[model samples]
Target chain A: MKKSSLILASAGALLLMAGVYLAFFVAPDAVVRIDDRELVRYSQKIFYFHVPVAETSFVFLLLGGLFGAMYLGTRKRSYEQMSYAAVEVGFIFVLLVMITGVLWTRADWGVWWEWEPRLTTFLVLTLMYSGYFVLRSSVQEESAKARFGAIFSIIAAVNVPLTFVAGRLDSLKPVHPTVFTLQGASMEGPMLAAFLVSMFGMLLFATSLYIMRLDLLRAREDIEYLKEELEVG
Target chain B: MAAGKQVFAIVKKDVLAELRTKEMVIAMLLFVILAMVVFSQAFGVILNDLDRVGGGLLWVAFLFMSMLGLNRSFVHEKDEGCLEGLLMSPIDRPLIFFGKMLGNLLFLSIVELFAVPIFFVLFRLELGASMAGIFLATIFLSNVGIASVGTLLSTISINTKTRDLMLPILFLPVIIPLLIAAVSATGGIMSGEELTEVYRSMRFIAVYDIIFLLVAYALYDYVISE
Candidate 1:
């Protein structure tokens, strides 16, 4: 591995460890006093990790869109591969967000799921990208697969925000807390710190995974090209 | 003007072809009516919430019916190598997209005109003239969104190994927001709710139609190209 990636991997590992510790121990538990008993929402701790993973997923999906557009403009396989890698890593994070999110929902709301804006949009998003992979596979030709995948990614990207808006429109009564906002006014103090730590840590982890996957995919593509050349020659 | 002519020519060709065979439209009509029959059986006969679920049922049928229409839209073109010929022509690519999308919109509207009445009769629902107008408006806007996206996706699906099977897999998730808005708008119209109640959904459908049309138009060149 390159020294930069090695450093990145180590840094990601350290920050992730620190973030998890801070999430559990350093960050104050949300406590409720009821009937002479102290009730704590341990499930709320999942929020720190879940929000970070979800944000990282969005960032990577956007990166996939960017790379997809680049692939179309240049017709370069490299950009397509990078976009695919980003989507794959992003999808992993999306699954994590859902798992952790469902856990939190079950704990907090006493249901396995809620049709809140974010949750519904996430479901749409997961399906959209899953369809992306499905579309990719159903195409037989390599170039056609890349082209269709790129176009689909761009469409999916544009739809993401629209889905968010529509989801928000229907969710007049949101079960999820509006912790982070565009204006950035809601959360404060240690909660904010913990969130930031987890956010950056998860982002770093996601980036490292994307980079690693891209490298592996590129190497595999190179091997396949060489084999094809040998067969033709 | 040249692009307009090309678009019209393509639309005319598709319409004439459909007029000759009438396969796509008939299939869509039957599929939708059958779906309505099934839903009425489930909701009207068994559960007895046909009124409550009418909007959902309508949009669901519309979505699947449009999927069927779109999946078959490019079949004759692909089978006859007509799509390849179209691509080789000097016509601009997005114009091709608009042509196909417009053709789809026309056919979906025809199916809707037939299906809506049958739908009401089957489900035993009543619609005033104004309510019918609102309902048709929702269908039109939703159709625009569906046809625009569906046309783009069907082009890609035509090139895929699974052909028509890939269309719904790619189309459904992408159409969720439009579906939500359309279903809500239809629900509002069906319940005789205030225009304000359906206003947001109507706006959403319109906006979704415009955005998806533009995005699909912009991306059509890449998809139709080799």
Candidate 2:
């Protein structure tokens, strides 16, 4: 486990460095025309990292849900730990997505924020899961905390797909340009390599964070258990 | 021994308790009325065109009012150790969810009964002749959606220190689809549009109600067991 974690950590660092170099230097600037105004933009470079992070966060969220269902079925403490870890990692990645999104919006949309569907839905998901942490902390009893947190996590997880569907199908909803089809030069060799590296790096970073947090939580629990044993002795 | 009898007993206990105290119902109704008055005063200039904004105001009032009722209902159970007793009973956990949801729906509907008229009076808008029944259906279904999910979340939140504040924070995001559906349906009805136009939103709310209720019902056991 230690060796694998160390490998992931090194790979993540290497990928992040590659991503920064490629994003700033290798990727060409994108030109967009809005309201007949041709805007030559460089900040479109954020897309390489932004899109992959956002995609990864959703994957993490879905994994969290899957772990939540497992916890409910097996009633095992490990599944709950994994689920909590996934959500914590998901939160960090989602926050990074939001920050990059804001930067992109300010450059492209002439505003720091807009209520576009993707942005709005992601905002809602961020709040909903953050509330999950608050829910966990509010309960003092370990058993009750685990039970309620698991249940809430599962419920909130089900809402994610529904939210995505609702955002897509609502007729009154505003349109966001589909990233894949948008006008941009297709990824060249170096840029593609850099993007993949960064993506792998983010996954490693997320895994490391999850493992660290879980270890800390388990250690805390161990301390509490030993204290109780000492008191009884 | 009978399932029906157990369900009846649970419902009766909740109803009788609320009847004697009138705390949850009265507080919810008063809060809705006061909120409406405050809204009206705040938007006094827009009163002349109240119909334009009435649908939004009605939903805002309902959302906050439901929050008030949900928090109070669970707090009452927690206050007297009644929820612990309920958990200790041999009855199915889902039944408790149903009983509590029914009680909340009943109280919310009664509050709406008063709120609708007060809203019409203050806002000077009348439901169109053709849309009255659809409006009622929207209200009924919206309340069911709110009560079903609200009951389960309130149970979870009641254990937290920030019980009152926590309910809305935890609830509003989960129920955003319901809010959007209710507001759109109400808007459609107010504007004398065809029910078919609002069918999508109604179906959305119905689907949400079923999915969430079933999820909440299945999970209630774990929540109360701990």
Candidate 3:
């Protein structure tokens, strides 16, 4: 990583650690009442990390789509690299969201998975972006690969939100389908502070990673260009 | 000639080709019917209360069968250099997309028309006469969404190396939302549920179709161009 990205990444790591400390040590435990019993819900702690990660993934994917459209409109190589890097970073976050989401569900709901609206939407989003990589690999031509990838990214971005909306429809007859209760509903001052810290940290960390990946992609292209120049000379 | 005329000419050519060969529709019909039979044997017992779940089987069969047809739709154009010819012609790229989409929509509807009746008979279910129009409307709207998105994606997939295998990978995920809405609507209609709920799903399918159609329209030129 370059100096700027390294610094950003370090700051992000520090804030995230602080967020963790605040979340566990400072924030009051979430209490759930079962009939007459008050019980501390430990799994609620995961909310600080899980929600921020999920939101960060969505932002990156949305940026992936926006950058893709920009690349398509301009046919600029820099835009294409930015688009690809965004999707790649966004894809990592998407998987992290999936894993954390599953663990959270299992911990809180005592089930491995639920076909709830939010989960179902995220599942489809995962599948769609997975298709994006498959699509990028299937084409051999360079410009065509970039073009197709950009197009699919834009489609997937648009389609992900639509999938979320569609999930809310009673069409899947979701066993009285309701979205999983977002656990952040009970946040107090400490919890809020921790969440904000984590959210900013996650965003900065993701941006740093995106920049690093973008630089790597551009460097790879440059090396290829240099090799071609030597071969021609 | 007018854009409408050009589009119709493209559609007409596909119709004539299909009429002459009877290949795409016949194979689709065969695949669809066989899939229903497979469903019966696979889920042989306790399928009696299949009204609600029947939507799942029906869509899986149609979605796959549509992919088969969609791949075939573009294979001929690409194999015979017809896509190049289409590009070289005077018609607009978006017009070409609409033309091909209409052709696909027609074929999918026809196959479903035959297959759905056979599905009802084999499964021993009656949609009752009154709800037939609504059921068909749901199927038709779903088909429109399928054809629009399928046509656009199929155009892209055919250009890639893994021509035959690529369409399903790209198309299925993109179409899942529409599929969910379709299943909800059809299931609602079959279970003799509220008309209002069924209409909502149908409206969703319609919105999906319009959104994809507009997307394809704006993007097809870039897709088909070099």
DockQ of each: 0.76, 0.57, 0.78
Of the candidates shown, which would achieve the greatest DockQ relative to the real structure? Answer: 3
> What's the C-alpha lDDT at position A81 in model 3?
91
lDDT of 1 by residue, A1-233 (tens): 85666677778778878888888888899887899999997788888888888889999999999999999999889999998999899889888888888888898899999888888989888888998999898888889999999999889988999988787655245778877679984767788788888778778777788888999999999999999999999
TM-score of chain A of each: 0.92, 0.87, 0.93
lDDT of 1 at A64: 91
Per-candidate iRMS values, in order, are 1.0, 1.4, 0.9
Residue-level lDDT of model 2, residues B1-226, one tens digit each, is 6777777778788889889998888888888889888987898888667655677888998999998988888888899999889988887776888878888888899889887887777666787665777888889998988998898899899888887878987998888777777877788778766668688778888888889889987887777775
CA RMSD, predictions in order: 1.8, 3.0, 2.2
Candidate 2, clashing residue pairs?
A: none
lDDT of the candidates, in the order given: 0.86, 0.81, 0.89
Q: Of the pair 1 and 2, which is ahead by lDDT?
A: 1
TM-score of chain A of 1: 0.92
Better of 1 and 3 by lDDT: 3
Candidate achieving the largest TM-score = 3
| lDDT score of residue B147 within candidate 3 | 96
TM-score of each: 0.96, 0.90, 0.96
Estimate candidate 3's RMSD in Å.
Answer: 2.2
